[model samples]
Target: MKEFRAAVEAGDFEGLGELLAEDVVFRSPVAFKPYEGKPIVAAILRGVGRVFTEFRYVRELADADGGGSALVFETVVDGVSVNGIDLIRTNDAGLVSELTVMVRPLSGANALATAMSAQFDQIVAEASGASS
Candidate 1:
C-alpha cells in the first residue's frame, strides 16, 4: 500500500502502471462512473493532477479483507486541506484491480465533486482521443 501511495503522491504513472492490472477499475466518488483499463487509469491520474498539489499522506490501515487495504491521505487543493480514504484490491500478481475512494467533511464535497467531475471529463477526452 505504501508503494502505491508513494507512486500516487509522486504522480508517477509509469511506476503505477507497473502495479495495476490490465483490466483495472478505478471508481471516483463523483459521477459514479468507473474507469477501466490501463489507458483510462493513466487518464484518471492526469485529471487529478489538475486539482491537487501537495498530496501528503497521513494515516493508513492495513488490508481490511486480510489482503485488500485501506489508505488515508491528506491533500491540499486550492489552499483547502482535505482528507481522503481509499480501498484497494489487488490481483494475484499484486497488481491493483479495483479502487474506491471516500473524502471527509460533506461540506467541502462540492469542490471535490467539481474537481472530480472535471477530472472525469478530462479522462474521457483523453480516452476518446487514444481510442480514435
Candidate 2:
C-alpha cells in the first residue's frame, strides 16, 4: 500500500502498472463496464492522473485481515471539487487485482465524465496515429 500511495503521489503510471496484476480490473465511477486487463486499466488511471487536479488522500483504512484497503480522497476535476474513494483488493502475490472507484456530487461526476471521455479519445487518437 505504501508503494501504491507513493506511485499515486508521484503520478507515476509505470510504477502503478508494476504494482498491478496482469489481469487487473478497474471499476470506474462513470463507465458502465468495468475495464478489464492491465493495459486498459493503466490507460484509464493515466487519464485520471491527468484529469484530476489538487488531489489529496484524506484517509486510508486497511482491512483487519489484510485482504484489501480503502482510501478516501478529494480532488478537483474540471473546476469541480469532488470526493472519491478507492477500494483496492490485492491478490495473494500482493499485486493489485481489482480497484473500484466511487465519486460524489452529481456536478463533479458529470465534469469528470466529460474530462475522462476527452482523455480517452485523445489517448485513442495518439495510439492510432502512432500505429499509422
| Candidate topping TM-score | 2
- Tens-digit per-residue lDDT, 8-79, candidate 1: 878775567677788989887665778789778867766676687778767778865556888888776666
In terms of lDDT, which candidate is strongest? 2
| Candidate 2 residue lDDT tens string, 1-132 | 767877897778556878889899999999899888876676677778888999988899999988799999999998999999999999999999999999999999999999998888755543344311
Distance from true position, residue 3, model 2, in Å?
1.3
lDDT score, candidate 1, position 59: 73
Model 1 residue 51 CA deviation in Å:
1.4
lDDT (Cα, 0-100) at 18 in candidate 1: 74
Off by over 4 Å in 2: 124-132
